[model samples]
Target: MARIAVIGAGTGAMAAAARLAVAGHRVTVYERSGTYGGSLGRYARDGFVFDTGPSLLHLPAVYRDLFVKTGKEPLERCVTLTQVDPASRHLFADGTAVSLPDASRAGVVAALDQALGEGAGTRWAQFLDRAGTAWDRSRRPLLEEPLRDDREVAARDPYPAPRRRRLLRPARQAATLAQIGAWELADPRLAALLDGYALSYGLDPRRAPAAAALLPYMEQTFGSWYVSGGMRELAGALYERCVLRRVEFVFGAEVVRVAEKDGRAAGVELADGTHADADHVVLGAQPGPELVPSQAWDATGTRSAGRAAAPGRFVVMLSLRGAREAGAVHRTVVHCEDGTGEQEAVFGGRIADVPTVTVSRPDDPSTRPDEAHEAVTLTATVAPHGPVDWTDPALRERFADVLTGRAALAVPGLRERILRAEVRTPAETAADTGAAGGSVPAPALAGAGGAFLRPGNRTALPGLYLAGGWSHPGGGPAHAGMSGALVAGLVVEGDGFRGSR
Candidate 1:
């Protein structure tokens, strides 16, 4: 059996460890923090709980596959995963509101038509149909399988944008997400809705490829899920599964470097001046040059070398004094008044005057002290820590106030109902995840000359592989799980392993 050394105790790392252990490989995970989950963090105060990271899970099939492969118990037995009905409520800047039904194309189309106009629903449906084509074309290469290095194949944008004729110019198809929204959707609200999806994932809609439509397609088709307690519970379940598989974990053992022997990854050197030898090494953290040697993985022409700066999330957790209103949607998005300004602020390293805010109010008793009290979270996509001073007290307070003001549109008397407020910024994210500039990685897209794709799972180093948000298939809960699966596949089945069937 090969001895495997994993770099972090993040979900991706643990997932790989469990699978490798099940394959009879002795695996040991080294984590810097005293916790298991990386971005899947939680915060509690006065019996109130909040998910400091992703509030919802999309494409849960990834985790389901992980559980099925690792153990006899299915994912449902480990964690109560429920589909959130009326997936989300959108409050437009013009005071128009619509609650879209979960995973129902007809229902979403009808709601959009009734709320916006007679043709709005049809337009959205058509856009989704086209988006489905993109999903079908890119799902295998961009998500299901290992990332291919062929630039021609990776650079191909799978979005089938319809050709549009112009009065003074030649016919052209939409390239960027913004182009698709303005030219094809033909409605400002629809454009804003599309932009919101892109921004939430740290993608700049203005520059993000039209193939990014697959994001909404994936969510609306597969549906959004919520764990019984919080997203952190999902992490706990996975960690438990790893433990059940006999995967050893070493908490607070920070890996400073990947040791090499005869030009192959030999083991890991810890920050405490210790080393653990392994036949294979898997990296589940950000593959920074400091951790992974430059010679092992040259970033010269790879996707890792030229990836754009990703945005970070600013969160405000509210402990309200009153109970949640009956029939309130679990998720509500308050659309920004100025989309252009918000995009500029996020992508251009500044703060917008008014930013789009997503408010989450999970109907779970575990998050609150009692039925008389409620736990609510408000989040916005903003510039990462390098550009914005998330450490400044004034900036944090001001941004929290702005988010609360925007969330007021979704929650009635939000400020008055708040018993306490806790703010989290990119600064906190940097501290928690150790991501440079607290930048959250976006999912890989198959467009923009392969500019949006991430580095492949395999590296120049024979026994070393990359997993997690910063690597192949890119970020998000499901994608990270996929990265772990890919890494395990490579280690267990050799490099010929394509992906899980």
Candidate 2:
């Protein structure tokens, strides 16, 4: 068995370690945070718990595979999955609203057709049909596996077998813009598609890649799911698996630099001056950590290196008197950012006079005496603007007001819903988390230059392999897990790892 060292104890790193350990490799995960969850870490203050990171859980099967491969049962440990109707809504600036559906979401399509037009439903159905095809073709190639060594994999295991019409079919040809424009409808459906895409690359539908055309169908058709509680459950589940496998987790240990020998990464040295060695090293490569080497940052300097990370929550955790939706664990209340103002500021990297909130409500059992409601998690995306004192007392209050104003734009008396509110900026996030500038899974998504630009899973340095968001397969939670699995696969197979199945 290989003595493997998986870096960063977050979702991506943990997933890689779990997959490797199950595969019979001796894996040890090193996490800088005292807690196991990366950005998925939870912040519980008083009686309320807030997900410090991502809220929604999509692509449930990717996570389920982790348990199944390890000989564990996800259903045994977690709550059953539920498909939410009105998966999300877009309240347009002109007061017209559009709702996105999932899995034969005929209702949403019907409702949308009224606002958009008579043929809107059929147009969406046609778009989804095509989107499904693209999703199948690119799922494994573009999203599941790393792209760096893609040609080699395609030459071998062309997943799904064309007969299955699998999304993970074998193929090539760089995913380009010309491809996405065909389906990116400009009406309400277009906005729905863009919102999902915005969750990843910050690219609006019109600007998003044609390869990403499947964005809507992925949620509406395949289904967007929710865990019993929040997405934190998935992270905790993975962490538990690591312990069960006897993997060591080293948290609160910040990595200072990646050591090199003869031009290869040899090991890592922590900020506390302790050194550790591994047969291999994989970076969770979550957002801020990528900028560590200084060399990791391209010519755009510190700012642009982190610019791609769309700013996330200024969160509000509410323990309401009652909830209308029970066991309905997932709901994202979308707030439109008008074309002229705050929305542009937040999306364009400018200071928003007001913030844009995407409220996430989790399942709560005690919201209404004997009844229950989806516990509420309100998150407003706010910019990290100029010259604010990192330690200033005034920043939180200022941003809270900013978020409150933005919330009023959509939900009236938004402040009344907040049992307690925490205004977290990028700087504050970096302070609590070791990740510099609160960069999560470090823009693992390669910008431009396509696949060649991202570092390969196997780095130039020997005994070092990259997993998580930073690796060739690119970013996103599930994508991170698959990337880590690929790294573990390589180490297990050794030179033959790059060979064939």
RMSD of every candidate to native, in Å, equals 1.1, 6.8
Cα lDDT for residue 491, model 2? 70
Candidate whose TM-score is highest: 1
lDDT per residue as tens, model 2, 409-447: 445445565555655566656665554434443223222
lDDT of each: 0.91, 0.56
Clash counts per candidate, in order, are 0, 17
Best by the lDDT measure: 1
Query: Cα deviation in Å at residue 455, candidate 2?
Result: 3.3
Q: Summing lDDT over every window of 10 consecutive residues in candidate 1, give the lowest-scoring window.
A: 299-308
Compared with the true structure, model 2 gives a TM-score of 0.79
